[model samples]
Target: MSKGPIAVIVLSHRDSEQVTRLIHRITEGTNSFAVIHHDPSGEPLSIPPSSQVAVIPDPIPCKWGRLSLVQAQWKTLQWVARNVPEFSWALLVSGQDYPIRKMSAIEQELAGSPYDAYLRYFRVGPDPAEDVIPWQALTRRRYLYKRRVPFSRRSVTLPFKRRHPYRNGVELYVGDMWFNLSAPTVAAVLDARQMSERMLSYLRFAPIPDETFIASMTLNVHPAPNVAHDSKRYIKWGRRQLHPQIITAEHLPDLRASDAFFARKIDRLAHPEIPDLLDRLAEERTASSG
Candidate 1:
C-alpha cells in the first residue's frame, strides 16, 4: 500500500486519563501512531512510558481562539514531518475526537486516492468577507481585528477591519481546523507556513487562527483539483454556542448515516457509551462488507 502507517496529531488539554486512552485506542491497530501536544495550562497528560504515542517534550502554551493554538499545531506537524516521513496520510484531530469508521476503511480510502489533502477550503478574498462562502459570516468574525481586554481573558472584536493579511496579497481561505493530508503535501504546507512572515504576524492577534492558517497555506501551495474539500469529520455546531455540542448516544443514527471517518466533542464523562457504540458499528460494517 502506498499509504503506510497513519500519523495522527493529537491536540489536547484536559482530561488526562481519557486523553491517554484515546492515544492507546488510535495507535492500537493498523500500525497507526499518534503524537500529542498537551496545552500546559491544563492538566498534565499521563501516558504510559511504554506507549507508542509520542509526547512533545516542551509543549507550547495554547489559548482558545488564538494564534497560540495554531502555533502548537504547527510545532506538532513539524515533528511529524521530520520523524514520520513514511506516513501515507496524516490526520489532525483533537483528543476528544473518536473514529466512527473503521481504521481499515480509512486506510483503504487514503491508499486508493490521489488527493494531496482532505479539508474544507473556501475562498475569502477579492471582495468583502460577507457571504463569500457558505460559512462566510462566522468566518469574517474570526479573521477580523480583535484585542484582549486588560486583566481579563476576554477579547472584543475591534471596529477597525481589513482583509485577511498575507505577504503576497493572495486570496485567503478559511475552513475547519482539522485536516487530512498526504506526506508530501504536509511537507509543502509546513514550508509555506514557515515562510509566511506577514500572515504569522496577523494571526498573533487573530481569533481562531488554526481554522484559517492551514487551509490558506494548503490551497495556495497545492492544486485545488487534487485536494478534497472535505475534512471527513462529523461535528455538530450548536446554536449560538462557542463550542460544538457534546456527542452522545443520540447522535448514533446520524453518525452511522454519514461517510465521516471521525466525530468530535465527545465528553466521555457524559456519554460513556458513545465509544462502545462506535466500536460496535464499525465491527458491523466491516463484517457486512467482508
Candidate 2:
C-alpha cells in the first residue's frame, strides 16, 4: 500500500516449522523485513537463513500472561526501531499466524492507508462502561498472588485476590496484542515505555498486560489517524476460553472473503491443509494484482 517495505515482528513460543512457514508466507512476494522473537525456553527455532528474516539474538524467556510476554514484544519493537527504520509499518503476528491475503496486496493497501496504526482498542473501564469479562481482570492487579510462568509446562497459577490499585490518572486500554503500526507510532510507543516507569511497573502485575500495554500506549500519540485502533487479525475467542480457536479448512471460505491481512491460531499439525489453502489464496491475490 505505501510502496515502502513493512517490518513483520513475530512472537513465537511454539513449533519452529510453523514459525518458518509463517515467515515464508509473509516474505513470499513482498518487500518486507521479519524479526522473530523466539521464546528462549521453548521449542528450538530452526528456520533456514534468509536476509529478510532475523531471530532476535537474545530471545526473551517468554511466559504466558507474564510481563515477559510484553517485554518480548517491546524488545521486538526496540529492534525494529533501531535496525529497520526504513520500514513504515510493523505487523505483529504469532508463529501460528498465516497470511490471509497476498503479501503484495497487504503492502499496497498499507502503503496507501492514511492511518498510523491498524489496531482495535477500548478503555478497560468506562464510567458507563462496555462490560466484558476482561474488564475486571485488567483494571485490578491480581497477578501479584495469581501469577504463573506462562510457558512453563509444569507451572501452576497461584490464586489470590487483592484490591484494585488506584490509578490517579493513568488509563488502561485493552485490545488484541497483534497489530500493524506505522514507524512513527512504533517509535512513540517505545519512547513512552522508556519514559513511563510508573505505568510499566503497574502493568507488570496487571492481568494479560500484553493486551493492554501497546493498546494503551497508542492513546498517548496525537492526531486520531495515528491511533487507528483496529488490529486486522482474524481470531475467534470463544467465551470462557483461555485461547482462540485453532483455524481449520472449514474457515477457508471465510478467510478468502474477509479483508484481514492475517489469521491466527493455525496449527499446521492439526490442520495441515490450511497452510496450502492460504498459500493458494495468496497466489491468487498476487495473480489478480498483476
Candidate 3:
C-alpha cells in the first residue's frame, strides 16, 4: 500500500544552515514536505532549494522569550494547511534535532496507525514542585536577555497560575513540545479560540511555552483516543536537569531501543557519531523490512 505524505515543520531561531542540513538528511528519500520557521534574527538565511522554506518576518525590536516564536509556528501551520496538499500527518521538529530512524520505518508505522504522538493536557497549573529550580526554570532565560525594551519584572511572573483543562477536578498533564500530530488534530489546534490568548500569555512568563500549548489545547479540543501518550522523539535529560543532554554517538544503542523517529540537542561540530547512527538505523530498517 502507498503511504501518505508527511509534513515536517522545523522551528529554529538563527540556525538556518542547521535547519537546511536537517531537512536534507531527513527528507533524503521520502515524500515529505518541510517547512522551516526562521526566528526573527536579522541575518540572511541559506535555505535548500529542494524544500519549501518560509521566513517569518522578525518583529522589529524583538524581545526574547516573547510570543514571536509561537506566532511563527502558527504562521507555518497556516502555510502548510494552505499550501501543502494531501498530507496525512504533520511532525513538529527542531533544527537542532536529527532523525534516528529510517524514513521507511517511520512511514510504515505512521501509515498503519490512526493515533497522533504528542503529550496532552486538559488544564494548566503550577509546574510540578520538583521543576521549580534554576536548572529547570532558568535554562531558557538566555533568550530573554538583551531585549530591545527594558525587561518588566511583572512580565516574568508565572504564566500558569493553575493547571490546564481543569474540568471535573482532574489535573491535566502537559505534553512535550515536540510532537507528531495527525492532520485533524493540527486543524483543531489552529482553530481553537484559546490558542492565541493562552499561548501569548504563556509565552511571556513560561520558561517553555512550546511544551504546554499544543498539549493543553489538543486535549481540550480533541480528547484522545487519537493522541499518543508518549512523544516518539528520544531525549536524554542532563544530570539533575530539565533539558535534554547534548546527544552524541555513544547514545546510538539507546536511540535504537527508543523506538523513536527522531532525537534532539545534537552537537553538530564535535559529534562524529551522527553519520554512524543514521547508517545503522537505515541498515536495521532495511533488514527488518526484508
What C-alpha lDDT values do all the predictions have?
Answer: 0.77, 0.74, 0.62
- Superposed by TM-score, candidate 1 places the C-alpha of residue 14 at a distance from the truth, in angstroms, of 1.8
- lDDT for each residue of candidate 1 in 1-290, tens digit (9 for 90 to 100): 35578888899998887787777667766767888898888887788875568888799988777788888878888888788778777898898998877777877788888787899778775456345545666566667656555445666888886545643645578888999988888877777654456677777766567888888878777444378989999999987787998988888888878888788878888878877887787787778778
The estimated TM-scores of all candidates read 0.89, 0.85, 0.75
Evaluated with TM-score, which candidate comes out highest? Answer: 1
Cα lDDT tens digits, model 2, 151-184, are: 4433334555433332554465677889888877
Q: Number of clashes in every candidate structure?
A: 0, 14, 10
TM-score of 2: 0.85
Q: Give the TM-score (vs. native) of candidate 1.
A: 0.89
Ranking of all predicted structures according to TM-score, beginning with the best and ending with the worst: 1, 2, 3
Q: What are the RMSD figures for all models against the true structure?
A: 2.5, 3.8, 5.6
Candidate 2 residue-pair clash tally: 14
* Candidate 3 residue-wise lDDT, 34-108, digit = tens: 776655554446874664444434433233344455566666777777776467777888777887777667777
Model 2 misplacement above 4 A = 1-3, 129-169, 193-195, 223-225, 286-290
Which pairs of residues collide in model 1? none
